[model samples]
Target: MLNGLKVGDKAPIFEGLDQNGKKISLKDYKGKKVVLYFYPKDNTPGCTAEACNLRDNNTLLAEKGYQVVGVSIDSVESHKKFETKFELPFPLIADIDKKIVEQYGVWGEKKFMGRTFDGTHRTTFLIDEKGIIAHIIDKPKTKDHYNQIIETWEK
Candidate 1:
């Protein structure tokens, strides 16, 4: 597995289908700050909280010049359902092949309930306008995820 990426590293580029089957690429958000977040699955509790928090503050995030995008190994259909259920305003990338997660170095071994398995680690990358990583939140606070991004950027 690839080592975790750090701040100042070049943000990995990726393109994948979103909930609506439209292609989303990191390069598309060039010249703008991007909040690239990775979650284990769609519709899960923590994932839902994080996504909802971002959705609830979409206007504020936009006003702060941030574009949010979520990624998970879930299928496009699943992403669509989750987005519809939560009314998420940003695109949730369907990383079915796991390529995007691997590119961003978020795919790895995880431990939960005394069991270990390979999965996507819940992580967030703040990509600056120039495509460089401004900050990385490895252990995100699910309910206050948006604040973490904002505070990091503002700092």
Candidate 2:
């Protein structure tokens, strides 16, 4: 488990394909605050709700100068469907190899239906303009976690 990527740690660098099949790199988002969230899969109830929350709050987040991105081990095609279904305005990265997930320490053992499995653990990282992690939300919720992040940013 990541335990967490604490404040002041260098934000993990990643280069992955987006839903549109375009490559996206964490370095490309440098000089701006970035919200990188990791979820287990797309279209699942909790993941859907969490993504919707980020989608709905995206405008405000942009106004606040934060770029919100969702990541999962799902394929680019799956991300496309999820983005369309939710009308999401931001990019969602396809991490099929789970490399980025492992780098950020979001991929780990999790208990689901009383069975343990290795999967994304609903983690969110707030990387500052300097590309250093400013905060980490390891126990992410399906709603208002975006708002919670904004609040944290305000502090």
Candidate 3:
């Protein structure tokens, strides 16, 4: 098992192409709080719900000084389609190479319907402005993810 990051750990920095083919680097968000979330796929039910929840709460998250960034092994084209279809306001990183996901240690074995396979885990890392991990949500509540994040930070 890869050693995943945790609270108080310095977040691993990486860059990838966003849905629009724009290069987005973790270093660019240095002075801003970042919510880096890793999911299994694009256009999936749970993933869609989580993304929509975040989209609906975008203003609130922005007002609270948190910028959201999503990462998945899905291609840029797939991400673009998902964003356009769902009106996602945040940048979704297309980690097709799996570099960023591996760096963050979110890629792992998962079991679904009694079938086991390696995949990206649904994880969220709340990073403070200094790039230190403020909190790590391993089992995020898809529908109430925004509230969970806000409450975690508030606590």
Tell me, by TM-score, which candidate is best: 3
Which lDDT value does model 1 have at 46?
Answer: 95
- Give the per-residue Cα lDDT of candidate 3 at 73: 97
- The whole-model lDDT of each prediction reads 0.92, 0.89, 0.94
Instruction: List, residue by residue over 1-155, the lDDT tens digit for candidate 2.
Output: 37556788998789999999999999899799999989899999999999998888888899989999889999999999999989989889999998999899888888989999888989888999999989888778787787788777787
lDDT of 2: 0.89
Better of 2 and 3 by lDDT: 3
Candidate 3 ranges with C-alpha deviation above 4 Å:
none
Ranking by lDDT: 3, 1, 2
Question: Tens digits of per-residue lDDT for model 3 on 65-84?
Answer: 99999999999999999999
Better of 1 and 2 by TM-score: 1
What does candidate 1 score on TM?
A: 0.97
Model 3, TM vs. native: 0.98
Backbone clashes in model 3, listed as residue pairs: none
Residue-by-residue lDDT tens digits, candidate 1, 69-134: 999999999999999999999999999999999888888888899999999999898899999999
Residue 74 of model 3, lDDT score: 98
